[model samples]
Target: MVAIDPEPLLAAGRLAHEQLMNDACTITRVGPPTLTRGTSVLTPGASTTLYSGACRVKPQRIPRNEQASERLTVVARYEVALPFSSVATDDLQVGDTVTITASGDTRLVGQKFAVMAVDFGSHSTAWRLTVEGAT
Candidate 1:
């Protein structure tokens, strides 16, 4: 049996996924707020762009009983997937922010989110990000 290269196959799969269901997303680095004397100032930082993106943002799914019993405030959680070539995996950290444009709604543009986790597949050309609402 001869060996076959998987790079081309992976690239094709990524392309198909991108073209079919991807949107635009921006990942911005979060830096510590600067403190001057006795005051603290917060500001936005540098950001990188991803042309093809997959973002899932919705309210946390929990049983109504459980939510009420625990007094759990269900907030929106975001999961974003991007092609491996878009940005370096190392550049995305837990504190980074991701702003994604809603696919069909212009009124929901630039929804902000905070990165909670970053998962990179060992053999896949994609990055999966788990995020939550950001202030």
Candidate 2:
């Protein structure tokens, strides 16, 4: 499923897809639905939640003692690139569940911001996401 802006300039991206235009990650928010980052056919200025198949999920089953300083291992469900900046920080842990949808070949990686926000250019992305709730 892709999201299209109520207007008529966006590309209407496809959800649940794996695209690698840049290293950044695009995403779909919870409400007001805003494609903060990445690229999409949906309205460029209309707030919305865009979906894409670009996520970083890790399964961490470490003991309590090892939780202090252990890195989580992640895998990409699809052969696609998410949208974002150089850094991504979120509370999502391993074994969490997430969903990705899209309207085009754009992608974004995010898991902490309730409100999505991209650069001045809709194409600027450079972040990764770690969504939880999936085993």
Candidate 3:
């Protein structure tokens, strides 16, 4: 198994927060829910249904301060994962970019962003995103 140092990890995390404030774009995208999965079972002679809702877009948030500390208050939340999926069980990485395709009549067609604070998902794969790029 690969091993990583605790010191560098903390440093990188702190750095990400700091880097976010300088040139980061925090955006919030809301998407509709879709059927992510389905299961069926028959007991006796009855059937039942179940439904789960997921977020469909990636939301980004950058720190408001360049000198913000990694002490909870200095951090923000973002939805970086495909809402069409389940919960995220991985941590975010550095230098990861996700391209978002906007669907609307607006001028925004093709836009790409760099994830800075995934805080609670596998890289840029979460219910939200905290990116630091121009929209």
- RMSD for each of the candidates: 4.8, 17.0, 17.7
- Measured against the true structure, the TM-scores of the candidates, in listed sequence, are 0.65, 0.23, 0.32
- What would the per-residue lDDT of candidate 3 be over residues 31-126, giving only the tens digit for each residue? 333443454433332222111222233234554534436543343334444331333323334445544444332332345455565455333322
- lDDT digits (tens) for residues 22-104 of candidate 1: 35666777455454555555554445542335543434433232255657654566567776566555567787777776555
> How do the candidates rank by lDDT, highest first?
1, 3, 2
Best by lDDT: 1
In order, candidate lDDTs are: 0.63, 0.33, 0.39
How do these models rank on TM-score, best leading? 1, 3, 2
lDDT of 3: 0.39
Question: Cα RMSD (Å) between model 1 and the true structure?
Answer: 4.8
Candidate 2 lDDT, 4-46, residue by residue in tens: 6542333223121223342333443333345635675454344
| Residue runs of model 3 more than 4 Å from their true location after superposition | 1-81, 84-92, 121-126
